[model samples]
Target: MRTGRTAHLLFLADATSVHTQRWVGAMAARGWRCTVVSRLPHEVPGAEVIALGTGEGNAQWLAAAPRVRSLAHRLRPDVVHGHYITSYGFWAAACGVQPLVLTGWGSDILVSPRESRLVRLLTGWTLRRARLITADSRDMLTEIATYAPRARLEQVYWGADTDKFHPVAKAPWPFRIVSLRAWEPNYHIDVIVEAVALLRQAEPGAAIELHLLGGGSMEAPLRSLVRARGLEPFVHFHGKVDEDRMAALVNQASVSVSVPASDATSVSLLESMASGLPVVVSDLPANRQWVDAAGGFVVPAGQPAPLADALKALLREPRLAEQMGRRNRATVERQASRRSQMDRMDVLYRQVLGWTP
Candidate 1:
């Protein structure tokens, strides 16, 4: 049993994000009291949810700030943690909440900063209020340092649950590839389709299948691209699957691909690794940390030729793919296990609260 002074946490984040739900659940399981304050209503097992009912877009957050602040005063949490620096961090800081912890989730720091001067100023100002800031990757920490130079920053991964994502035995059939990233412009899901088209010619008469497992704005256009390339029979779009079904799909595939243009350490990528599948991912600095030469091929984002080559190579050499999958499983167990990362976060909570073992 967990024995310690309980830490009451007030989390500000998007209720829709799987990252937020997972983190809150993990902390609650560890005996921390977690209350989520979100604009969107979500059900996190073991935590109390205060649905702010703030609608879509950034402007809505301004209206929701007063409610958030009022709730904070009444609750008097031991710590206030904001998941996305640009959105939740803005509100947490605006409310003048102290002992705040802010986590930068990739695009919030990388893409949002470039939106406008006001946004950049607001993000930096909020970072200043944070007692500590957390980011998923070392490269992300380097980026956060520019915005909040004096603020303490820690690299903490929102890790994949190893127990839930571990590999299951299955006899392989035709070569199958899974891309679970959303069909958004940023994730470049279209690139996966294009790469599959290129691979068809590289390995003539070879039976191959591409499983696209997400939903986004680019769905219609991605379908058009697949039809245009005459890849309708070869590709299957399984839109926005849940956890259990997604794990079943991953276990059935021989390879996985997540070549987003930019990302922090992806939970999907970690799950793919934990499932003992070799991945073909973008060569971005963040991905480079988890996917090395031993685990899989790293291709340049948006380049079909290299991605096609990587995919074709894996299909041709099944033994090589298996070896990489084994390496990936071991690597994820060592570096990205959810149990280990959550344990680390628990330590940080104690340290922040000045509670000794």
Candidate 2:
């Protein structure tokens, strides 16, 4: 099949997510004619918006398929790219689209596949049908292979905007530990709180503060954990902030923590690395890829004692943390920059469609 001159790309995503917006924007910036069909109310600036009728899961596709088919007929896109493979890709492939590219976003391959036979079968179907598949981490790529052995899967790390997140002059604060993830169960914010409490016990006058950003269902539970652990004074919940403010906040932190129960590739970890902050992350496969001995410390998941030890060690040796932060930032520049990720994605897209450019 001859590839079309103008690549009409369709992104299927949950309406409110920034990931979809970022992907659409990035593709648009590269001059690909883009359309995003989402359950979101607000439309992205540069793409044609098709509002999805249902919330999420397989049932959503029943309502969304006709709308997607209508758009497919109208647009006649060369490639139909689904953002979350299990949800959107299943529908797109079931609709019989050509040159389908399915991108697996973490939990779909890692956690969702373990739920039930029905979900696993559906997810497997999507993976099998896609002409090409992409995952956010090498770990995720391996996980997806377990279900779809013959599927062509590539690891495409979620890139960070290095221009937006970079090193700033060190702040005069004593010890500021920041977390830029949602207050969700998988994130293990409770572990962070416990670690903070332990840090306080060890160093009574340790001028350490924990900054929890983003919001989720776990906010109340996390707050209660903070109070119960006597971390009310040391922990500050900033809710959610805009991208610019978030970058600033991350740059101000002495170190960043991401003690998730499990993760494929965390955008928060990449963002913190880009901002030149030393990270104390879970010793999961995903985190290990980013946090080497030089960049940051990787602690065993769900263990607050070791996490506290790592945090306290960083706090005690500010210069070592600073050096590690610089290394982390360098790693981001070399591996996780937006340009590098987009370049890999563009190549993959072209390969799926058999296009030279």
Candidate 3:
């Protein structure tokens, strides 16, 4: 009976990130009022974006907390939600809002805490401040438990819009591969390029095309590596794209590759799966939760030869790839559909505010 009243959510998150956009967009579509406070430049359709700081480094992030609390005081939102445990999470905590919600994106809980004792303590401070906390993976939840032993928590997938990402009729024998991760060192984009070089050698007769989506500081180095490996004609860099464009490119491919050095459940990986494309991913504990032999191949991170070998196997067997794609789609429908995850979030919001019809 959530028909009459509306919940207004104030979020502190990356305005440019598609993940943040999905959260705000979904809630907005449900007729809830949404406002985002971000340092970055971008828009989440249907939600208001409040720019903070100069859109730069760590100092700006740290300096914005007091201002954030002031904003919270004025906004008086029904829920104050923070996306990213180490940064905005701190601000959400400082605001002293009732029913504060914090979501620990992968690196914050796993990588950042190990940076130093100060970071570890700060992370704990944010976790302890929130009435409800969410993470996309079990390992993330386990790490959250370490920081705030008694914190209430939930597993919430960023998830894929199944309709947008679902398989499209394509050239049955298409020899295209797509990588949607950022061109960052941790993501091992170079390894994917090197593996593609190996894959080219393994399948010299076939016309293999590798498409790299998204961008970062590693772009110049990755392009140089592609040139050095003589894969210029085969690998295409499309930079960052909108959801519609991302879905189009993903559907145009025969398979997807995402071998990051570390990760939680990736929205890109889930989107690729929904598009009915077999994936070759890293052997991370989080990846193991989603990809398996029936769905995709998992290889050691930063190892080109093994990754290339996995890619080669998929390249040779279109039928096997197609079968794997089906398995992946089924898995996503059962576990990572965006609509379902949004429903879970809706329930979480109600529980947090004690809302009823």
Highest lDDT scorer = 3
lDDT of each: 0.87, 0.82, 0.89
Tens digits of lDDT, candidate 2, 234-346: 88899888788888888888899998887888888999999998899998998888888898899988999999999988988888998999999999999889778987887
TM-score, candidate 3, is: 0.96
lDDT for 289 (candidate 3): 92
Query: Which of the predicted structures, 1 or 2, would earn the higher lDDT when compared with the native?
Result: 1
- Predicted model with the maximum TM-score: 3
Query: How far does residue 44 in candidate 2 sit from its true spot (Å)?
Result: 2.3
Ranking of predictions according to TM-score: 3, 1, 2
- Of the pair 2 and 3, which is ahead by TM-score? 3
Once fitted onto the true fold, the runs of candidate 1 whose alpha carbons sit more than 4 angstroms away are: 1-6
Lowest lDDT 10-residue stretch of candidate 1: 1-10
* Better structure of 1 and 2 per TM-score: 1
Give per-residue CA lDDT, model 3, range 196-219, as digits (tens).
999888888888999999988899
Q: Which residue pairs does candidate 2 place in steric collision?
A: 15-40
